[model samples]
Target chain A: MAELTYIEAINSALREELARDRGVYVIGEDVALGGPFGATKGLAAEFGERRVVNTPISEGAIMGLATGAAAMGLRPVIEVMFVDFITLAMDQLVNHAAKLHYMSGGQLGIPLTVRVQQGAAGNGGAQHSQSLEAWFIHVPGLKVVMPSNPADAKGLLTAAIRDDSPVICIEHRALYWTRGEVPDGEHTIPIGRAALRRPGKDVTLVATSRMVEVALEVAGTLANEGIEVEVIDPRSLLPLDLDTITASLRKTGRLVIAHEAVEGAGFGAELLAQVQEAAFDYLDAPIARVGAPFAPVPASPVLEQAFVPGAERLAGAVRKVVLGA
Target chain B: MTSELNQQEAMELLRTMLLIRRFEEGLIQTQKSGISIGHFHVYIGQECTGAAAIALLEPQDKIATTHRNHGHLLARGADPRRLYAEILGKAAGYNKGKGGTLHATVAGLGFLSTSALVGGAVPLAVGAGFAAKQLGERCVSVGFFGDGVLEEGVFFESLNMASLWKLPVVFMCENNSAGALGQSAGEYPGSTIATKQLIDVVAPFGVPASAVDGGDPRAVRDVTQQALARARNGGGPTFIEARTVRWPGSRPLWPELSTGETDVAFAWEPDRIPMAHRDWFANDGLIRYVRQLFDAKLANTKEILALDATVRADLAKAMRFAIEAPYPDPASALDDVFA
Candidate 1:
């Protein structure tokens, strides 16, 4: 194991994948320069320009090129800089990449992994700070993953690169610098499994991505208040580990789902529906949700702080569900 | 630079063009007879561009084409039986009834994929070329698009990156002065600037660009050869705009939706050309190619007629196979969504 930040873990995963497979390469805007953040820094120096390709500021072309390269027997890891900009490449990602294997009658496979950082941080306004995991999880052919810490980040990225399907890895911008212990070499987490960070009996706090960190903090505070909270991080959103969440809900008899995206139509809603269906009668209270309000992320520090959900917001939701408010 | 073709190569080119023409004709006839459903775009008048450009591609090379892709697929040696089955939405089709006329792909034949969206395939070709470069392969990738594709932002982005990386790709624009949904090129806004010549738009990218007579298969073949050679030799991409006419008979799926006029029309009778307007079928690529074959004594009329008969018979057998093929099982619809 090695102590690394979330960004360092991602960089390590890229380096290991690049060294592991000849077909694996990285391509995206400013990727050679380590992208806007430093998640891809120093990769080009080690791999050379041919493998660590830097593309123009064209999301559509970047996505289309990656899709084609994947279909033509290459494993391409594409970075979109930010999650919001993925909208520009939706045609290629949603229409072409997602549908190629199905549309081609299983004659082709697109082993593509698109990496994009989301979550509001550093006053990065509406455009750059939005969380769009729900948009990708809704697509049928896509595999959506969000890692809460440096460990899962490395493991999930490795798994995504090895999978023979199109996987979208959503990394939270705020968590890039957060340090944690990650397995050193060839560590891979299965795409559809959930990780239980804490065990509790009163309520279950099901979270994703950055919100998982918030839930962990909230769980600690709740425990001091004598409200034992279970924290479950669903690493992969599409093939959700609903079984684990349901099992936790059965034990806790209450649920509070949390995410950084908007409350309405977010991944929280999908989890709410699934948990209710699986363990409907186990509820000790109406399920609570912690998410940003239905407004765009603002640029001002105060508004941005208020816009993003934090440990206090999640703790409040947990208190509401646990105390049956 | 002109790439000389032996008589056998020239004959093969003629055969490919004729085969595409006949294949499209067969599809039209099948559609008319109510055997096929859904919309299809035929490469009727612009056969030479696809046939000739694809002829220059090596087996390992790849090509991504637009919705009007039957010609490119056939020219690249995709099986007619499978293509016909796909158009008919049969389980035996290339895409197992999932991709019909608008999205058929035979990956084994080096025809990577086809896109119903205009200019969608351009960036894909760049990706394929990038893969080739990374793998140290000498394969060159080609993207066949229409004149309307120039307006798409992705096309320009593709060109910029391809040139910037010196990727081995050839952007072949089959300019027929028309867009999708049967809109005239002149009718679209900024048509004057975009449609005048493609070289002007690509010149800013510092890539070699040229315009050629798309009607003559040999001319297209020579130009395509030069571009492919440059790409294979690590020279940057080349943009070739082949000027041609959209076949008058290439009507929309719904005849009523057609604008009652074609952007370019050809005269069926050669003798009437003198009195006809210069734009009235100024150059029929198919006829021109056939004339070259006869004039050069590469094939006599009897031989040419026999070749046409063979193509027709083969298409007839393909249609029979397609008609007899089974429909996909409803339960299988969910398969192949992911590998």
Candidate 2:
């Protein structure tokens, strides 16, 4: 095992997948130049331009090309510069890529992986910083994944490239610089499974993507106060590992769900509804949710800082759920 | 210039156009008789464009088409029985009744896929060419769309990328001067274009463009051959705009009235339709091609009648097979939704 940042781990995964399968290739805007965030740095030099392709600034055409290439026996890993731009390609992704295999009556398979970077950072403003994982989670025939750490980023991406269906991997901009220990080679994490970050008996804190780190920090602070908090990171959102969350909830009756997206119509609402349905009788208190207010991400530093939920907000919610305030 | 055709080639072209014309007529007759249901776009006047363009492509070459795709699929050699069954939503259809008339796709016959959305198949053909080039395959891919597709941004993007990458693809635009609602697309309220010639739109991308008479099968076949040859020789993508007209009977058939707004006077007598609108019938591409065949003496009156009889008998058998085919089991609806 070696310590690597989230972006480095992602690059490692791409290199390994390109070397392992000749049918695998990368295509997107500026992907050959390592993209805007440097996640794909030096890939073109290693794999050559044929494998690591650069495309024009056309999201619809990029998605269409990837879907067609995937249907014609190539495994393509396409990247949209930002998650917000996915709206431009929604028709191709939702209509063509998601429905082709089923519409063709089992005659075609779209083994394409679309990577999108979300969450607010660097004061990138409203158009560039919105978290749109909820849109993909509601779509059937699509696997939605959000990796919380460097290890999960590498392993989940490798698994997505190998799967025989369409998958969307949402990577947070804030998590790119975060470092963690990742396996040396050939590491793949199974989709639809949640990872337990911490164990506690007082309450369960369910987090996703960058929120996992905040939840862990809250757990550390609560540990000094003799209040235990268990953190569960749901790696895959669509085929959610609800059993793991329910098991943790069984141990700790109180629950607090945290995410970076808006509180209205966010993925947190779905988790809250499902948790209540599964473990209604076991809950000692009503579930709590921590998310951004119903507003677009701001451009100013102060406004952006206030807009994002942090460890302090999560800790406050955890205390309220535990103390019945 | 139109390509020169020998006797055998001229006969085959006429035969292909006749097959498409008769097949669409059979569909209208069956629908009027209450044997089939669901809406479909008929390629009545535009049959020559697809028949001749697809004739230039090999069986292994791929082509993606729009909603008006029955003619293109038939021209690419799809089985008549399976295609008819597909329109009937039968278990024996090309997509096993899962995809109806709008989304029929048979990969074995070189049909990559069909989209109900206008201009949706343009980039898909470019992608097929990109894949073939990466895999070192010697086949070219083609896309068939209408004049309305020119306004879509994806079409322009596809042309630019195909030219930049030097991918072998042919963009065939069938300009029938009408949109889906039977209105002149050029005169539509929101339609605005700077160039009167469709070929000029792609000239800025450095791709060779041409226009031919879509009413003549020989003209379409010759132009498509030159485009395909250029693609095969590593000369990159080419754009061809075929100017044609939609027949008056191309709309949905209504047999209740003898002479209504959407009704044809001689529904059964496709051969005797007048050659001009002044004679109460529009000039059709299939009729023009058939006349050329007779004038050239490539097919005598006896041979033309014999071919028509064979096509009618084959279509009758296909309609019977479709009527008898079983419906898909309801429990299997959830199947094939994923790989």
Candidate 3:
């Protein structure tokens, strides 16, 4: 195993994909110039200009071109820089890439991966801080993945590169510096599965992205308070691991959904519906969700802290579900 | 230079044009009778243009078109019955009843699927052309669009990229003079001049371009032939502007809801120019040659109509099969969401 940061793991995954598949290529606005966040540093020099291409400031053209290239048997790992910029290419993603397979009656496959930084990190407020995973997860034909740690970030992205469908892989800018133990060689994490971070019996906590790490922390603190918490990290939001959640709900009988996105209309609503429908009878109490408030992420640090959900909010939700607080 | 096509080849072109005209006329009638449903855009006046452009292409060459695409599809040799059934929303349709008139596709037939969104298919052709060049297939990718799509920035970007890459793509602008009632070429003089100057601007980028009379199918065909030959020889992309007149709903079979009171009077007028052109040919005792050509075209179209009927019937059966095919299990809805 090698100690690597999230950004390093991503760079490593890109290198491996490029070396392994001749069809793979990368393109973005500043990708060749070491990327906007230096995630692709030295890639252009190592792989040459053709494989690591620098494109004009046309997100729509970049994505449309990538979709067309992927359909023509090229594995394009497109970096849109920020998830917010993905709005510019929504038509191509929504109309063409996502619907091509089902609309074409299975004649085409879009094996393209769009890499973007998602969720709030540091003081990048409002425009840059929003997490839009729920929007993509709503689309049917796309695979939405939000990796919380370095290991799964590399493994899941590699698998996404090789998959026969379009994958929207979101990484948080905050997690890029966080370190983890990733395998030395090639590895892959299946897209639809969830990972159990902390096993407990009192209450089940489901989280994604950076929220997964916070939920694990809260579970540890909750254990000392005589209340055990089970934490489940859904690596992929689109292909949700309902089997894992359903099994955990059967044991705990209490659930708490958490994410960095605002509380209302977030992925929390979808998870609540799924768990309530499948494991409704096993519930000892109604499920609770801890998330950002239903408002834009504020610019001030104090307001930003109040806006995002953290371990304190999650632990409070677990206490409510478990101790009837 | 113009004598490459013999009389036989010329006649074949006319026959294809007639086939599209008659098929569209029939569809207009059927659609009005409630036999076919949903949005149906006919390319009546644009027949000659499509026939001519497609005639230049070999069966292996690929083409992409916009939503107003029946003529283009028929010109590219799509089976009329499957297209008709598709318009009728039958399971045996091109997209198995899912994609209607706007989204009909037959990929294996070298008609790479069309995008209903304007200018969407143009960039796709660039990628296809790039792939064809990489594979050394000696094939050219053609993109067909109306005047409305020029307003999109991607159109220029596509031209620039395709030219820079020296990809074999034919970007044909069927400037039909109208983008749904607003005069197209007149509204945007600045862009029009730019578009008019595309051939010169693109030449230096390694891609050559030209414009033609879109109303004249013969002219379109000739231009396409040149473009394809240039492309196959690795001469890069070309942009052609086919300046054609839009015959506003010439097929009186499908009348607008606003034309309800005067529908019968409208039907009495002959919207097809060929029928009128035939009489003009006859008054000078040149009727013999015209009659012989018209008779052969009618015969060929009748044969295609017979096949169209069989395909429609087969598609009806397929529709029944799909409708009764059972809705997917609700539980399965939760599946395939992630991976």
Error of 2 at B318 (Å): 2.0
- lDDT by residue (B103-213, candidate 2, tens digit) is 888878776678877778888888888888888888899999988889888899889899999888999998876566666544622224556788989999999999987
State which candidate, 1 or 3, has the greater lDDT: 1
CAPRI category for model 1: high
**Backbone clashes in model 1, listed as residue pairs:** B266-B281
Give the winner by lDDT: 2 or 3. 2
Q: lDDT per residue, candidate 3, A40-147, as tens digits?
A: 888999998778878777787777777777767788899998887889888778777787665655566688899999777776788889988888888888999999
Scoring model 2 with DockQ, what do you get? Answer: 0.68
- Of the true contacts between chains A and B, what fraction does model 3 have? 0.27
Top-down lDDT ranking: 1, 2, 3
Better of 1 and 2 by DockQ: 1
Clashing pairs in 2: none
Local error of candidate 2 at A75, Å? Answer: 1.4
Number of backbone clashes in candidate 2: 0
Summarize candidate 1's per-residue lDDT along B1-339 as a digit string, tens digits.
113767778778778877887787777777778764677888777888888888777889988887888898898888899999998888999999998988899989876678888788998899998888888898999999888788788998999999998999999988876555565445532233444557788998999998898997767877888998999899979999898875656555532212122211122334544343345355768767776677677777777777777887998999899999999999889999989
Instruction: Give one digit per residue, the lDDT tens place, for model 1 in A207-314.
Output: 899888888888888889999999999999978888998888888899999999999998988888887788899888998888899999999999999998988778
Among the numbered candidates, top TM-score falls to: 1
Please list the C-alpha lDDT of all candidates, in the order they appear.
0.85, 0.85, 0.75
DockQ, each predicted model: 0.81, 0.68, 0.33
